[model samples]
Structure formats: C-alpha cells, structure tokens
Target chain A: MEKPVSTSPLGQTLAVSGVSHSYAGAQAVDDVNFVVPAGSIAAILGPSGCGKSTMLRIVCGLLRPGVGKVMIGDRDVTDVPARERKVGMVFQNYALFPHMTVAENIAYGLSGLPREERRERVAQMMSIVRLEPFANRLPRQMSGGQQQRVAVARALAPRPALLLLDEPFAALDRSLRADLQFEFVQLQRSLGITAIIVTHDQEEAQSVAEQLIVMNKGRVEQSGPPAELYDKPANLFVNGFVGHASLLKATVARADDGNGLLRLASGSQLAMPGPVGFVPTSDVVLAVRPEHVKLAASPTPGALLAKRVLSVPLGHLMVHDLLVEGATPVRAIADRASESAELPRDVFVSFALDRCRLFPAP
Target chain B: MNRNGLPFLLPMLALSLAGFVLPLALLGVFSFVDTSGSPTLANYQRLFADPFVLSVLVDTIALGFKVVALTTLIALPITLLYWHASPALRRVIVFLTLLPMLTSNVVRTFAWIVILGRQGPISQALVELGLAPAPRSLLFNETALVVVLAQIELPLLVLPVMAVIARSDGALSAAAQTLGAGPWRILVTVLLPMMAPGFLAGWVLVFAGATTSYVTQSVIGGARLIYLPQFVYREVGVLFQWPSAAAVAFVLLAATSLIMLAMTAAARHPRLAGHA
Candidate 1:
C-alpha cells in the first residue's frame, strides 16, 4: 500500500476539553471532554439527539463550541474556521458532489498542489480504497458500500490531522454494514490513523471501537474501553445503554471486611465479594448479564425460585425470559442441551456471582 | 398507465389545441399570403430584405438575453439570503417577492416610468447629487427597458432558485468546507452546479416572457426605440398592413423559439449538465 497521506506519518492526538454548546435556550453538549490517543479509534456512542452529533461537529470545527477548546496534535483550533482546521469529515449521507467524478471529488482538497501531483494523489487515494476501477463513476451509480468507501477516500486524500465520521454505517444493510465496518477497521489499522466515529448503535460501537464513550442527555455517562465499559458501567444509564443486563432491586443486609450479604427483593439472601461500597441496609441494584445466569434443574440451596414465561430456541442456544420473585422480569441465554427435551416451567435461577455487579440505587 | 392518464389529460389537450396551436397555425398561414390574397412568399421575403426589420429583430433577441443574464445575477444573492434567513424572515421575503406579481403588469411598468421620467425621483436625485448637469429623462432608452424587464422577470427566477436551494443537501457545502474549500470555491464548484437545473428552468421562463412583453417595451422604451413586437404593432395598427404584421409576428416567434433552444442546448453542455 502507498504511504498514508497524513503529515505526521503517525496519527496525532485529538483532545476536546470543556466543550459546551447550547442551541437557543437548550443545551446540546454540556462540558464534554475526552481524548483519543494517537493512532487509535474512539467511538462516541449515544442514542439519537443525545449530543454526540454536536460534539462531532465541534471537534471538526464545523460548529464552534459555545465555550471550550479543541486541540489536534497540540494545536489549539478552537478559533479556526473549518476550511483551515486541516480536519477531514465524512458526513452521514456521504455528501459526494453530484457533479464531480470520483477522481475530482477525491482531488477537491488538493487544489493547492500542482496538477500532476494532484492527479497522483487522487490515484493513490482511489487505490487505497480499492476504487481505482470505479474512478469515473458518479456516487449515484455506485452501491451504498462503494459510496461509503469513496467518501472515506475523499476525506483521507487531504491528509488531515484528524478524521471524523458521522454515522458511517447507518446507511447500509445489516450484512453490508458488518463487511464495511470490518474494512474500515482494517483500513484504519493499516494507515495507523486516529479516527472517531459517532453512532447510536451499541453493537457497531463495541465491534469497531477501541475506546467507547457513551453519552446521555448531553453529558458523558462513561468513557472507557468497550470491554471495560460493558463489564463495569459507571451508573444506571451506562449499565442500560452499553449492553443488555438484568438490574434487580436489593438492599445490603450486612457489610463485612471486603465482602457483603445482600437481600434481594425476592426474599432471598446471598453473599457477594466486595468492594461493595454501600453500608448495611442501604438500597442497591444488582446487575447481571444474561450469559451469567443459568437454570438450576431442581431447587437448590443457593438458587432463587422463578417461572419461565417464554423460551425462544435458536439452533445454538435457548433464550429464556424469566420472572424472578414472581414479578421482576429477567432474561437468560443458555445452550440448547438437546433439541427435543423441554425444561419444566418451574425452575430455579442461579447467578455467576463473580461476573455480576452492584450499583447504588437512584 | 397510458389508459388511466388519458382521461385526465383530455381537458388540457383540448384547451391547448384551441388556444395555442390553432392560433399559431392561423398566423403561419397569414404569413404566406399577400394583400391581394395571392399565395406568395413576398411577406417573408420582404422582411429579410429590410435593414430596419433585421435590426429590430436582432435588438429584441439581444434584449431577451440581457434581461435573463441580469435577472440571474440578481436572483442568486436573494436566494442565498433566503437560504440563510430564519423561518419568519423567509416568510416575509416570499411575501415581498410575490407582492409585485399581484399588481397588474401595466401598473408596474408605469411605476418604472414615474421613476425614470425627466422630472422623476431618479433624475431629480441625479441633478441634486451633481452627477448630471440637468434633469434628463432616463426613460425611452434600451437601458431603461432592460432594467424594467428584469424587474418584471425577477420573481420567475427567484422562486425556482429558492426551491432548489431549499431541496439541496446542506451537508454538501459543509463537507466542502471540511475538505478545505473556501466559501467562494464552494459556491462555484458545489452550490452553483446543483442549482443549475432550477436556474435553467427559470431562464427559459424569463427569456420567453421578456421577449414577448410588448407592454413593458412600449411603456419604458417608448417610440424612440422600436423592438420586434412594436414593429409588428406599427405594421398592422398604424400602416394597416395585415400581411406584413403577420410576417413580423411569425419571425418573432421563430427567433424566440430558436434562441431558447440554443440556450437550453448550451446549458446542457457536459460541464453544467451534471445535475441538469
């Protein structure tokens, strides 16, 4: 592959500090801050209208922050116009100029270079995206996946300090989205470019991003590695937004040295290892992933009583939606031990205590 | 689909055949016959033979082109302003642009007469500002005709261009800016090409309307200048020559149609044809 167009050879760090912007009387992004290390990928994951889009615009200099600083590679670009910021952005629709050919669109940012040099750079970018065969095709004539690659090629041709994409895979079908996301990760890895993709999909975020920043109601709920955030979410919002989990209301019945006893609302008492930070008789919520819950064939001493409401059998596993304590619903996924044997409606559910987490009640 | 649509299309087709095509056919036949009712090509031959008629024909077509160019230049900034304006301000702009069209064309053309007359506001202002030695009439001139005609055509161009701007993908310009294109470069490369289809449609409307606008030409241009429409009027009404008037009318129609075709073809050239 040809050398990456970035000037630093290695990508530069992107730092956004204390950035807060409001529209009219409503807050859009409130004191949001984060850093993506050089040559790494960060995903800003949030639901629609949660201010991730606003943060992406602010970082790329398209919309100036109402209050704060944006630094790329140690250069403070808070006051710079978007054209002079040396940042490349791929818009949600890909926004390829309908009038220009693929070669012209890719060369749009290289206007300052000599003619021969610009042509060479356009060729290089097309080659990087595996689009040399479609250089003359208009964006309307290409498929969604090909158009996305063209947008990436056009943005990277400028050799910008940082790359930002807004909902990069939101326009593709499920099968195509997976393939393009894989290509994007491989391409970013080969170029060693620092990039940020804003998306509302948690699965897409978890699969493609090294660092995942989850935002809610215009504030950062949590920012960490995907595995870290999924495994140890900071609060109720993060716990619910990052991945699937069952949160059961409970109270601390007793506290000891680095270990605790909890009384679940279902009238069951269990011992859990701590660093559980609450005092005795404090209200808390216990969070457990579906994969961590298993069905007990018969009632055991440590198991809790529950009735299976519904069972969906996939070829590889059966997903059971169970009501714990006869009221609160919890989901569990288990291997389909046999194809024809059906489990009893009345069974006990047990947790893998080491994988479960507890959070103080709201 | 054809069977389903034909019933809905009957009224418009009958109206066009009666109102437009039949009259044009009559005019064509009138151009072929002489005063004595002998079938002769003298009416057409006589037209090409006259220097005055040729100049008048040339001037009217040139006048149409000038009005189209001026209205396009004037409509762009208004479209841009409307694009950036708030919702309330946009409503106000639409009201102001359409307000003139609600008035009669004769009234609007006469208002231009009051503005450009010898004792009108413009001449008085010019004399007071010491730009002119005396109050001079700006009416009865080609410049006055072009300006007044462009004013009449302004709304035709502005509305369509505004609609195109509204339908445009705003992200394209934002994307261009992030690609390091300045405002002027983005306008030239991205925005203008996208607006071409609307502009071309507006051009056809303005060019056709302005060239045939006999009221504005006669009121603002006066008898001091003679365009093809005025020439045709003089032939039939003043000199009582029906054949000659019919010939001039047909020539005007052919010339206007030819120019519009050429303009459409040129606009469809590879560069501007991207969106068109």
Candidate 2:
C-alpha cells in the first residue's frame, strides 16, 4: 500500500453535504456527507443496497438530493442536470453503445470538439487504453475486460473534473478484476482525476481506494484508511465488515494500567487493551482477526483450549474452525507454508495483542 | 401431415399466383406489344415518345414523390410528439389517427369533396363571410387529391414510424445530449437516423398506395383526373383496351419497384445501416 500524499497539484475537490434522497418514499441515501480531494480516489464501501450508488448519482447530478448540496471545487451543482454537470460516469455494466466501434464510443463524449481535435483525442485515448488495434471492432465483439477498458477510455476522453464509477469491476471474474483494479489505480494516478467508486466488495475497496467510507442503512458508519479501519474499527459493524473477525463475549476484570483482563464465556482469561473511555468491570466484546489467532497442540500459557472441528483450505491459507467448549467456534487462518499436516485433534488458540479490538457489548 | 397441409395450401398459392403473378406477367408481355396484333415495342415507344403520355407519367411520378415527402415530413414531427406524449394522450391521438384508415377510402374522399366543393361547408363559410364573391369549387384538382391521399394514408405512416421510434434504444438520444448535442440536433443526427427504416417502410407503403389510388382520385377529382390507375381503369374497364391497360400497369409496377430499389440502396449506407 502506498502512503497517501498530503497534497497534490491536480486536486479537484468534491464535497457532498447532508444529501438525502429516496425512491418511491423509501430513503436510499440519508444525510450523507463526504469530501473527495482532488486526484484521489474515495470509495463508498458497503454491502448491497446501502445507498452508495444513490450517493454517486447525486454527486454526478443524475439524481437531485431532496436536501443539501453537492459542491465540486466550490460550485454547487446539485440542481444541475446530468449532461451539463461535466461529471463523467462509468456504469457497472459498462453501458457501451453496442452499435459503435471502440473508437467511435470513445469519441462520443468528445463530439463537440473541433473535428480535428476530436479525431486526435480519440486516437490518443485509444492508445492510452491500448485499444488502437481494435478501434473498429464493436463492443459486443470485444472481451469483457477489453470492453471495460473502452468504457473507461470513453469516460476519460472528455477530461471530466470528477469521475464516478458505480461498481465498475463487479461484472468481471476475479483474476481479471484484480488486473483492472491495478490498471484503474495507475490511470487515476497518471491522469490525476478525482474519483468516487461505489462497491460492495471489501477487498476491492481496500486495495484501490485511498479513503474508505463504510456505510450501512443509508448512513456512514466509519471512514478512514483501509488498514486503520481493519485495525481499529469504530464499532462492531466496521470490525466485522472490514475483515473477518470473531466476536467473543467477555467481562472486564480490572481497568488499571490502561488494560483489562477479560473472562470469556468458556471460563478463560485473556488480556485486552481497554478502549477509550472504558472502565473496569464493564461488559465488552473482543474482536480478533482469524489470522492473528495462533494454534498450538498443547495448551500454552494464556491460551484457550479447543477441539479441532473442521479445516477448510482457501487456496493459499487454511481456516481451522475450533469448538471451544461452551463457546462459539474459534476461526484461525494458518499459512500453508508454516502449518504441519499432522496437527493434534485438540488445540489451544491465543490472540495476538496488537490485532484485537474491544467494543461495548450490545 | 405434410401431404394434407400441401393439399390445402397449394390451391391458395395457385390462386395468388394467378391473381397476382399472371397479371404482372401479362402486363410485362403487353407493355412490349404494339397495336398491330404482333410483338413490337410500339406501346413502350409510345409511352416514352408521346408528350401526353409522358406528361401523365411525369405527373404520376411527381405525385408519388410529393406524397411520400410530405407524408414523411408531416409524420416525423407527429411521430416524435407521439413518442413523447403521455400514455393516455398517445392512445387518444393514435385512435383519432386510425379513424380515417378505418373509414372507406371513397367515403373519406367524398367527405373531402363535400368540404371543398362549391356551396359545401368551407365554401359556404367563405361566401357567407364575403371572403369571395361566389362559391368556388375545390374539387377536381391535384391539391384536393393530395389532401385526400395524405389524410387516408397518414395512419399507415404514423403507425410504422411510431413503432420504430418506440423501439429505438432511448439511451442513444441521452448519450447524444450528454455529448453536447442539443435537442433538435439530437433529433436530426440520432433519432431520425435511427428511425429511417420505419420512415422508409412508411414512405414506400404510402407511395405505393397513393400511386395505385383510383377511388380517391376519381371521387375527389371527378371526371377530370388522369392519374395512372384511373387511366388504366378507363382504358380497360370503360374503353376495353386491355393491352394498353396492361402496359400502363407494367409501367406503374416498374416505377414503384425502382423507388423501392433506390430506398433499399440508400438504407445500406453505413450511417443508416447502424440504426438497424
């Protein structure tokens, strides 16, 4: 992951404030607010139907917010119609004009330019996307990834100040999706265009975005860098959402030294770093990532013992689900390179202190 | 099953062949036959050489083109209005337009005759208002024929053109507008081009119907009209000149076919072909 630069010259800022919208009386976006700095990618990350797409539409001027304003670099363009807003959007399905060849589709948005300039820019965009050879081939004739490239080229050809992509890579297969994700990041960097991508895929959002806005039920739950979000989630929703974490109910034993000893439901004591404003004897839930849980044959000091219930291999890692007596299954991801095949049936698991998060139990 | 189906279908096919193909073949044969009871090119020669026949041919051709052009120009805006109209309003407009098509052609033409004729409602109003000294007959003129034909064929034109516009992917128009094409430019550059097939189909139908019209012209123009179909009817049915009537029929068929061929060729252009 690259460090986010504090500032950049190509910055084109977009601010969406208190924007609320609905469809047929059902609210899709409720008082959503965010700022996407210029030349940076801000991702609206959420599960499906979380109103992320609605927010994108409102920002692009496709849909007007029932309340509040959308500002692009100091211009309040909330009421502006989609065409005149000068915001380019890429649809999830690419939405390429099927009848037009690749070059023609890329040239569509630049049609108002002088004929010579339009042709030159189209040629330039075709080369930018490396689609010069297939310029005359219709969209239906191209592969999915190629068509997606053409779509991106078409949207970028006009040099829109703000680009909005709605689940742009949702339709591609996994391998192709990763390739396009890197390509899009590189393109955004090169062009220095501000963008907001709406996606439900957490891995995609974490990998491509500079800032992540996690949303749920038309409200922003958390917002920060992907690693920060994964490491210190604001609430249970963010903890479970950003990455795989098992929630274990525990009672805090003491509050001294900024740490508390928690007794799990299975009658095991585990050390927990107290969250800000938390006190001793308070009930709390511990969030521990599966990869941070270490598995051992014999019971290690400060480790909880459990019986091995199942081992599921996920290509490069193995997830062991253990039945800790009188408690929920404990999940641990073991790297395939370090794990031994002849592991004992009963094992003990301990959490790495740095990877655990504490939140008020609810 | 095949044997049984063929038995039932063969007679209808034969009937159609006799009713349609045989007459066309006879017309083609007679078009080259002269009046001296021998195979000659005299009829065709007369068709090309005689000023009167040539003038009538020109008039007929001009009427076909004029009717088609007028119908298309009138139908396009009306169809676009229909495309954008609310569902209820669209239904009402469609129903009203279809009323003329439902009525008999002769009745519609006579209705026009009554309105445009001397002492009819139009002339009565005109005369009553002292717009003119006396009632002037509007019957028996090319203008009256055109008005009647256009009214009669309008629904035919509207239905097909509307279907085309309705089926066209509206995204193209939106795409055009987003690309900086204004409403009128979008209509001309995108919508109209996409709707060309429907317009072509409608124009062909209207042209063919108007060119072959005998009832409307005869009823509207009375005895003075000399459109090709009326001329053919007079020659064969009234004067008993079957050969000349067949020659005239062949000429009309050739003209209509040539128009269709030209339209088909124009439709093949890359800009227009993409619409399909």
Candidate 3:
C-alpha cells in the first residue's frame, strides 16, 4: 500500500470527563477524568486490574463508559463507534492477523485509500519499523520484536489521529523492552500524534510519557508529570506506587516554631513543614526514599537509632536494610565509593526532611 | 509415531481394517463383478445407461449440496451466538446441540415423520392459519427430506465452527474493529477467512453425512423422491440386482469424492486460505 498524497497527520487532543464503567456489576473504572494535549503522549500507569487498560479502551471507543463524555479534539465522540473513532490500538499480544502477511496486515486499515497510496504508505511504515525484509512473511514466522513492530506499523499505517497501546511491551523480552520502548517513543514523537499507553510498569511509563496518570482500584490516584508525582506525591498510594519508598509509622508533634514536628516510633523527633490540616498527636505514615535516609555510624541529632541487618551491593551503591528502633524495618542506601569499608552493626538513620512525604494513616 | 506408539495404535488399526477398510475393499471389487462371477463392465454400462439411476445419482449430489448450504446457514448464527454467549449459556447451547445426536438417527427420522405427517402440528397449523385448504401430508418430499437432514447434520457443522472459534484469539476481531472495519467488513475480511479450516471440515462431514444417509432418505423421502441410498436399497432388496446396486453405490461414492475433492482444493487456495 502507498501513503496518502496529503499532509502529515495532525494530533488531536483527548478529553475524558467523569468516565466510569463496570462489568457484571463490579466497577472497573470510577469517575476517571484526564486530558492529553494534542501532539503529546500520555501514559496510564497502574498495577494489574487497576482499570488503566479499561480507561484506554473507553478512549478508543472499544468500551463505552457507563457515564460521561469522551471528547476527541473538539467533538464529543462518546456515542461514536470504535470503527469511526479513527483510533489505532496496539494490543498486549500485538494481535497481528495470523493469516495475513506483514504487508497485508499493515495495509488492512488503509482499505479506504487508493491502491498506489496504500502501498506507498505500507512501504513507508515498513521502513519506519525496519520490517521491509520480512514484507511477505506471515506473523507467526517473525520473532516477537518483529511482530510487535508489525503491529505498530499496522496501527500507524492508517495515519490515525490518536494511537493507544495496551501493555505493548508486556510480551517482549526484558532485554529488548527498553530498545522497543525508545523506538516507539521516537516514532510517536516524529509523527506528532496524541498517544496513550496503558502499562503496569512504572519505569516504562515514566520514561515514555510527558503526562503520567497513575490509577488504583478503578480510580485515578494521581496525575501529573512523573517527576512531580515522584518528588511530591498527592497521597500515600501515589508516593508508594510511583517509586520505591520506606514508610514509617509516626505521629504529628507540636513544635515551638511554626514548623511541624513528627515523633517516630523510635522516639526520635524530626521537624519539617507538615500538612496544614493535620492536628498535633495525629497518626500519620511518613514515607522517605532510600537515598534520602542517610546512614551514619555515630549518633546524629534528630537521627533514629538503628542496627544494620544486611547490605546488598548494587553497582555503585550499597542498599542497607536497617532495623530502626529494633522493630521498624527501614531501607537506606550508602555510597559505595565513600563507604567502601564495612561498618559496625549499629548506625543512625537520618531523613532528609524536605524529601520525606507524610500521609494520614488509614 | 515412534516404535512404542505403534503398539498403542494396533487395536484401532485392527478395528478399522476389519470394520471399514475390508468392507469398502470388498464393495469396490463387487461393483466390477457380474452375477456369473466374471469380471465385466456390464453392471457399470447398464447402471450408467439407466436414466432413473443417473437421475437418482444427480439428485443425491444435489441433495448433499442443499443440505450443506442449509446446515451452514442454520449453524452460522448458532455458532455466533455460542461465541458471544456467557459460559453458562454456552454450556446450555452445547448440551442442546449434542442432545439430538445422542438419540439414534432412526429415532430422529421417525420423530421428523411424526412432525411432518398429515395429522402433525405443522399440517394442523397450516390448515388453521388458512395457508392450506386442508391438512396435507408434508412428510415425503424433497423439501422435507432436505430440512430433516439439515437438522440432523446441524450439530456436525456447529461443533467444528465453535471449536475453531474457541481456539482463535478473540482479540483478532477486536483488533479488526480498532482497525476501522465495521461489523460486516470484519465478518467478510477477517472472520470468514479465519474460519476456513473449520468450515471445510464441517462441510465435508455434513455433505458426506447427507449423501449417505439411508435411514433419513428412505423414511422422509418415501417412494416419490428416490435418493441414491434409497435406490441402492431398492435394487438389492426388491429386485435382487446385486451387481447393479453395487455399481450405483460406487457411482454415489465417486460423485461425493469428486465434489469433496473440488471443495478441498478450493478451500486450500492461497487467496482464501492465506497460505503464503
């Protein structure tokens, strides 16, 4: 098939407002709302069964939301059928047509195009995906990576306004996933199309998407730039899910200064800017990233007394599992370059107050 | 199979040789031999020359074709329903489809007779609805025979298609939907092509079953419409024409084989089957 004799496709903005869906009386997506600006990529990141994929399907018009409107560009397309949505989706398994050759599969969506243009489009897509050598080969004959590329090429061949990928790298080898992910992001950027990717892998989502929407239990837990969500999570779930963190049980303490105070279970007091509405003596879960919890052999001011249980070397850093106050398990990382010599069992764990996040206890 | 698998296969091989292959081989030889125990083409020449026998042969092939077409038409929707049905509903459909096959074909043909008889519900309904002047015997006609045979062979067609659909990746159709294809386009471009293997298998079964169905043909077809199976039975049982009966039977077999060969060839075509 040849490419169409027209200008490159322009991306369309997607706005999902108060979308909710259920299957067999069980809620799958609950009041989900987000917007992907035109020509930008957004990622719906969540764990398995978090309704991210369901939300993507609703946007693609595969499954209609039980309530709310889906706006693509300036049109309210909630009532539109999947075939008329002009959305291309790459399924988890790729779902390449087994009976069709690579070229045929890529050309399937271009049925409305002229023969010469469709062929040209197919040839262009094949070159983009680097599958020109296997043009006549069937899907089963290609390797997993090649099959994935074919799926991408097929979805892109029609020059759809938006592209949706559901766990596109879930089936690829772990070693090959990064390369494909990079390639897909490049392809999507070069095309300048609105794209949504649903994945359970946080790293993959953060790496590829400009806007990240994290979902949990059928609702969006948090949505923002990945760095913002990582640096200052909106809630405990987002803080714990977006990146690795150690949660410590603590209680809000009254401080002489305007700053808030936290009393850890280890009987150590640390002062920081606290949530305004939190009352003193209220229970809260304090979260801190491993890098922020610095380990020191000697006791430091406001540092929790801890005993190092184990240390695992990770290339340039050493991850130490420390038992703070002999009960709370806290993970801390020490620089391998500076802390080359083995340390004693007892150490003090200090928190970078600004980097720590505190949340209300459930 | 390996050496060990041969021993496991011996019992089934022995049963097929004794029950099926031996009888077929004997029938092939008998079609060539005359009553005087001499190898001759007299039987073939006489049967081929008989207009009634030739008509019966042609009618049998036509009947097979009709049954295949009707059964396919009937099974397609049922298969689609089964594909979209819930697990519990699918189980119920499976049970109902296989229920008819559990009873003997003779019993089913008798049941069809009762339904299509002059005093049956269909005749009574036709008279009551003012569609007919009186209760007429609709039992013994080509239409009734074809309808009954299609009903009998419906399960054979549905089961294979359902099995193929079950083994297929349902996401393929969803993929097609996402590719901007409407339901009708998806059916013609994606689904029907993928179902070729199952369709071919089911077609062969239904065609073979319809053509060789002696009990259904003799009971429902009666004396007016004489299919090849009924004709074979008449030549041997009523006239004691053993050589002519065997020749006619061979002709039936050859006709069925020829059609099946063409169908198989068509199904295996690269355009239809997508074999690169």
Candidate No. with top DockQ: 1
Report the CAPRI category for model 1. Answer: medium
Return the lDDT, model 2, position B109: 77
Q: Write the per-residue lDDT of candidate 1 for residues B97-183, one digit (tens) a residue.
A: 999999988999999988999999999999999999999899888988999999999999888777777766669989999998899
Per-candidate DockQ vs. reference: 0.59, 0.21, 0.43
lDDT of 1 by residue, A262-305 (tens): 99887788788665778999999999899899887688768888
Q: How are the candidates ranked when ordered by DockQ, highest leading?
A: 1, 3, 2
lDDT, candidate 2, B160-179, per-residue tens: 87777666554565455445
Q: For each candidate, what is the lDDT?
A: 0.88, 0.80, 0.87
**Greater-TM-score candidate between 1 and 2:** 1
TM-score of chain A of each: 0.93, 0.91, 0.94
Give the TM-score of chain A in candidate 2: 0.91
lDDT, residue A326, model 1: 95
Clashes per candidate, residues 3 or more apart or on different chains: 0, 2, 11
In model 3, the runs with Cα more than 4 Å from the true position are A1-8, A22-25, A253-277, A295-329, A332-339, A342-349, B1-3, B86-89, B235-245, B265-276
User: Tens digit of lDDT per residue, candidate 2, span A63-158?
Assistant: 788999998888788888777766777877776765568888888777667788889989998988899999898776788999889878887777
Per-candidate TM equals 0.90, 0.72, 0.90
Q: What are the candidates' interface root-mean-square deviations? A: 1.7, 3.3, 2.6
Docking class of 3: acceptable
lDDT (Cα, 0-100) at B149 in candidate 2? 84
